[model samples]
Target chain A: MQNLRIPGPTPCPEEVLKAMGQQMINHRGPEMAAIMKEVAEKLKYFFQTKNDVLVLTGSGTGGLEAAAVNFLSPGDTVLSVSIGVFGERFAKIASIFGAKIIALNFEQGKAADPALVKKALTEHPEIKAVLVTHNETSTGITNDLKPLASVIKGAGKLLLVDAISSLSSINLPVDEWGCDVVVSGSQKGWMVPPGLAFISVSPEAWKANAESKMPRFYWDLAKHKASIEKGQTPWTPCVSVIVALHTALIMMEKEGMQNIFKRHQKIADFTRKGVKELGLTLLAEEKYASNTVTAIVATEGLDVKKLLKIMREEYNTVLAGGQGPLEGKIFRIGHLGWVTENDIKVTLDNLKLALPKAGFRS
Target chain B: MQNLRIPGPTPCPEEVLKAMGQQMINHRGPEMAAIMKEVAEKLKYFFQTKNDVLVLTGSGTGGLEAAAVNFLSPGDTVLSVSIGVFGERFAKIASIFGAKIIALNFEQGKAADPALVKKALTEHPEIKAVLVTHNETSTGITNDLKPLASVIKGAGKLLLVDAISSLSSINLPVDEWGCDVVVSGSQKGWMVPPGLAFISVSPEAWKANAESKMPRFYWDLAKHKASIEKGQTPWTPCVSVIVALHTALIMMEKEGMQNIFKRHQKIADFTRKGVKELGLTLLAEEKYASNTVTAIVATEGLDVKKLLKIMREEYNTVLAGGQGPLEGKIFRIGHLGWVTENDIKVTLDNLKLALPKAGFRS
Candidate 1:
């Protein structure tokens, strides 16, 4: 199989996948609880926080939903910053939970301005929380979350960050940045399959959880916290994925967090340089480009769909298309988890071969 | 590993486990969507309905939360029939969602009385829905869903059934029996590892969803339905689990639904007979015994905890223990999913060894 070039469910280490193949165990048993406790502790270490991290047996979107349901009440005003598909999804999810969302929209390939977020928070004193995406995967724009969190914190509001693709690939000190609630998934920089999602809760976020009146049960934070204190989960978790996460976290620990972040930056630099040398236009602002994935505007009049299809069918390389308004306008190449300069080279070579056949003269 | 004798995360077939180790795919891409469509279609076939089957990336409890959040609103009255741990959990989840609960409590190790449920609905006409557990794994008692559904349907009240352990092992003709909603898990009768949970909704349930004021986003029925109509999911799913589920459903189709049900019945019958020959007291009433697993009460002063530990540590055979008030009072033996007659023989032999160690003289 050609290497996966998508943002996530990126190529996982063979050892990580093998860890998931272990024999199943009863979820309510003590052994399972031990595994859960270790995962929770390791997650806190990865997030670089002393706060509690709760694991949800779902995707990163599920983690986002948990934050919404556990922190905001019906009719509560929330300021949402949207620059790409995932940013828009946060607004959509907030609306579904009956929250009155005030969305600040930006161009598809741009990042939301933290100044605009501050303006909205000041104007709407009723806004209880401000939602921002640390890394907008659709546009490959990595917003400055430290500044955004400062804006929200200065306004005396809770800050929720979607750090799904940015957690380990980029520098996100959850506590240092003052992010109230941060959501992430296992598949991205963790080098595992797409199953488990997690969120680290600050004391401020937990306080909001206490007064939140949203209807929730399985994703309820109170039950989760109570169970976590006992070294277990309120529900039966995805055991196989949890096992896989344990192995992945150990690898991360061995590499050291700072080194892992630097490695991702190096690979991202290598990929962006290669794409530029190939005469492709980067989608996001150069100063704000994401370190996990790179979005390239389709230049030289290339058929984005045809290029993606040929690469997948012939070379076995899978790339992601631009979601929402960016569809047919840009394509994304991922540089997260188990990805290296060599993998990026392979992807670029395939793109070079497929572009000519897709009507690109470059 | 000595066989998985527990109710869930039961011994999965090697092929099913290996399927989970398949290379991960980008969840937002068409490849993952195609896998999701196949899994959903197979689930629809297994559910015996043309209604939409939505999969969530969580455990069985996550599906239960989806049902409660999507169907009932805050201050809405729900009648919950509680006979065992799962039944009580249903009530707990509903209450957590701010639903006013009227519980119909039955004795432990017994099934809920259909008459009681009817009377409760008769008195409280404002009750928006009724939650019932088809098979309470905690007590090994399978309630009569048909009779209960008949009563609720006659009264035109919405019926939500937790058919987690009973879906593939027993007969639950969702449409014919007038079940408005049903929730299940992949780890149980689906013969796969824990990761995915599914729920089937009827027209009446859809109507309730339209008027429901519960705060939900990820578990929203409308969102799931809209995406399923396009043969996709709203967020990233457990792709490998979906592959395993597709393979498992194909195996189920070949076995035929009726034959699979009968097989469970035969195994359950043989187990009950063996327990009776050993002169052990059964926890569940014979008239309402579940076909999935059997709960054996500690007779002749047996140390249930010691017996369980010995079985696990020495023989590597995992047996479930009584939950809630019955903890340490009984041990459960599951015959659900991929269990053969020889498994039963091995379990019985281990029990014979454990009984004497537990200070049981016979």
Candidate 2:
């Protein structure tokens, strides 16, 4: 296997992978109930919330859709705070679902400014909700969500957060932050493969659900909540991934969330320092850099495609290229889940060697 | 492991299970592209469709929702044909999405009559589409889809099918049957775990999609189609499941569809016959019995719950109980995907022994 360094779909542990290979079981039976009950409880530690963290079988985008449709209806005004591609994606999902969007976009590599978000809300007093991404994986910027959450919650509007790539690595306590809905996926810091997405809904979000009138059935959060309470899922779940998640959660519980967060922070700091030492420029604003993934801007005359190709083909190291407008202008290295500092050392070492070959000059 | 006999989530082959344990790879990279291309091509063989087969990362219900949302707008009249629980589910999904449903109901253990469907469409000329369930796992009754497709398509209406429990196990040639859209799940006859759903769309469905005005984003078929053509999915797909599916599909190709269908047929026949000899009555009408799952009626004075428990606890044999109104009134034996005559024999032997212990005099 190549040294995979994408933001999500991070490498899983051997125990988790082996757990995924177990035989299929009756999803509605006692066996499934035990797994669901245990997994749901343990997820509270990762989410750091007392709210109901219902699991759905899909990618992170599905969880974002669930968050949007369950809280706001057509023509309802929503302030979408965008820092990068994923932040913009949450806004696009809301717009597609009929929410009138007031987009508050920051610069590509900077986090959302809480004051600007407050100004947008004041300008559009009709805004019923605010969408925020805790981490923008595309540009490797981690939004300072506490102050943003405080501003949105102070305005008494629903706060839905896309914590897809940040929840397990970053320290965002859902209840402490007063986030009404937080959406995440299994492929990120959860140390599992992609299949399941999780959503933690506050009591305030449930209140929104009662009156929200966007057309949805499969992505219904209320149905997932009810079924999860019964130790069941409304639809047939991805049993193998859930099994894997259970194992991953157990491992997480053993390591503790605080330690996991510290490990990510340490590795990310090491990566950023190493990249600078190698004469590379970081894409993200220094203070707001993400702990899960680090983005490096391609200098002029440097072949970003050739750089990625060389890393992947010659060294068997894979990294993510920028999405949308940032495509071919930046590349990302993921340090989430099971990554270690030594892994970062090897990656940066490889980059130092490959940089010259890809036409990068000091 | 215990004998897992559910309609869907049938046991995978050892190779497929091991494949599910593979490490994560970049979903947008060439490795994933290769997997997607091969899986998409081989899926056409199973779907028996010349149309574009798109892969979506969700369960069968998500696929059904995709099928409905893509082809019809709000208040557009749709003829929803129902024989059992899953049939009703498809209509519920369409109804939730704001389609005006003209439900054509058939008796619970019976197949949908083509004549009745034709009559409903004739009476409801405003109906733009007809929803059919090729196999109803809840009642172990497979609809006679070819004739029903003929009647619905003859009227120039789109025919959307829920083949969740049938598909590869029983044959429904998408092109020949004129199925405008066919939805299936990975947990069924695919011999893989749940988490992915396959949808095949014909030219007629795409035309309908152009005019269809339903609020959707994550379940968007157009986005999925565009991305799939480039050997990618609209969302970060369930990588491990897709890897396992590749292995499962390879096994299927080697076995061939004809032989697979025949195997399901033979095992189903053995299960039905074995149940009859054990003095349990089948719930399905004789001619419409499903090859995937076999539902047996709970005889009077028999403790159905106790019977299932005895079978599970003593024999390590798991089976499905009925759903909705049929709950506790029937028990089902699944014979789809990786099942054999000997497996059926073992399950039957357990049931025969457990039936008496649960107060079934015979």
Candidate 3:
């Protein structure tokens, strides 16, 4: 079987896969209530926070919307710091909900600059909130979130984070970073399939939810909190995904989140160095590179499409293409979740042979 | 193992369960695109509409939100016809999003009266839309949607239907009924697990979409339409569920939609007869009875909780407890999706033996 090297829908272990096949259960029964409670607690533990971690039955984008719609009101000024497409998406979600967005974006292949963010917040004193992406999957850069959080927290504005690709793969302690709202998805380092989105809300975030006037229903966290207290969701949950996530969490705890994060860092470092050995420069600079995915700049005269085609067709290794403005300029290889060193060995070995056919000569 | 009969999250067949555990694939890659295109077409066929059908990575409740948010603007007058709790929830969702709702509820255990709906629409000429539930799981009543749709359509008002528990288990042709938007989920008659919601939007719905002013991002159907044209969801979908859904659709088509509807009807009829033979009176009247779930009144002096407990603990058969006002007054038995005669026989056989223990002296 080919190694599916995408950022979010990473390969799940056999045990995790088997859990998905479990029979459907009563989402409103005692079994689901127990599972829900345990899943929420384990997620909070994994997030390294005591905040109220909520499991949502949508994608990471939905969780991002949940973060924005619950906290920001119409005409409420917010500073949105962007490093790549996902960062831009967080701003777009807020803007769609009527927030006045002061978008401060960085170039591709770079991380968000906290100095610029501080300056923006200083100038836009009307801003009540700040949105930042912890890791930009498209750019393969993990922003230094703590400094940005400190800036927003120091200003007394709420700090909301899109940790969709970072949390479990790296060291993003939600409570320690002072993030008022942090959103993540199950298809990342959770080693589970896509479907469930998770978010943790701080007291400050709940305060914002009380008066925020952006129209919402399904994404409303207040209803979620109330229903969860009764051991139920506001709606029928995606039970099978929860079943899979419940099992995946057990695996994560067994491996230990610390070791899982370190394994990701080690594999990512190896991928970057191995790609460099094949004469492909990395997209994100070494200092700020993400440990979950490695973005590599395709060499001049080498067709990115051709490179991907050869890699998939002959080498049977799939990778992610650049998104938005970064399209055709770089390609990404994911190395998170249950990704193995042996898988990387196969990927790098394939790259060594496949690069020549794409007109790479060095 | 228990035979779970909880309206939704019904027991899936072995083949369907096996598909849920399949390996993950790149959600944005070509393989996923092909699967998405096929899924949409089959959903359109199953919905029996030439209109656009969209698949979302959320639950049935999320799909209901999608219907309200996409068609109604804030302050728009809407006539919400309620039969049970889910009906009330649709109105609640619309109300939450700022719609001025004129909730016209029928007596419990009865379907929406077409005459009353007509009168409400006539009196409230400013009502821009009408909301109705196709199947009320709590009361086990499926409204006669055709006449209601005719009245709303004749008035040139938009018609939105929450068919979450009804669509595939029975017949409600989208175009024939002139429904602007109809929402269903995978956990019910689709014979799959939860986590996937399907929605169909009519051309008339698109007309309403242009003027609707509900603030939406994650559940926005416009972005979904744009993205799906290229065979991708605006956000990452529940990949494994989609894989399961794809397999389930194949099985569904093989059985044929008409036959599947007949199967649900037959099982539901058998369940009602079996319950009646045990001296139980159905909550819903015979004419408006739901062909998915059958709600039976709890015997006088019988504790519904004790009945449910005995059936579950001793007999290993899980039945749905009455919801909302029906609590302690009724119990519901589901016969949708992959249910067979033997499954229902086991449940009814267990119920016959267990009811007397809960103080049903007869």
Q: Which candidate achieves the best DockQ against the true structure?
A: 2
Tell how far residue B296 is off in model 2, in angstroms: 0.4
lDDT of 1 by residue, A1-362 (tens): 66899998788788987887777887777787888899899999889899989988888998988888899988999998988899989888888878999989888778778888888888889988988999999999999888888888988998888999999779899888888899999889999988888899999899899999876777787888998877777777788889888899999899999999999999989999999888889998988999999999988888899988998888889999888888999999999988888999999998888888887877
Better of 1 and 2 by TM-score: 2
Task: Give the C-alpha lDDT of model 2.
Answer: 0.92
Docking class of predicted structure 2: high
lDDT of 2 by residue, B305-330 (tens): 89888888999999889899999999
Lowest summed-lDDT stretch of 10 residues in model 3 chain B? B296-305
TM-score of model number 3 = 0.98
The 10-residue segment of model 2 chain A with minimum total lDDT is A296-305
**Candidate 3 lDDT, tens digit per residue, B56-170?**
9899999999999999999999999999999999999999899999999999999888888989988999999999999998899999999999988999999999999999889
Which residue pairs show collisions in model 3?
none
List DockQ for all candidates.
Answer: 0.73, 0.89, 0.87
Regions of candidate 3 where Cα sits further than 4 Å from its true position: none
Query: Total backbone clashes of model 2?
Result: 0
| Candidate 1 chain B lDDT trough over 10 residues, lowest sum | B26-35
Better of 2 and 3 by lDDT: 2
lDDT of 3 by residue, A7-41 (tens): 98988888888889999988888888998999989
Q: Which residue pairs collide in model 1, if any? A: none
Top lDDT model: 2
Q: What C-alpha lDDT do the candidate models reach, one value each?
A: 0.87, 0.92, 0.90
Fnat, model by model in order, equals 0.82, 0.87, 0.90
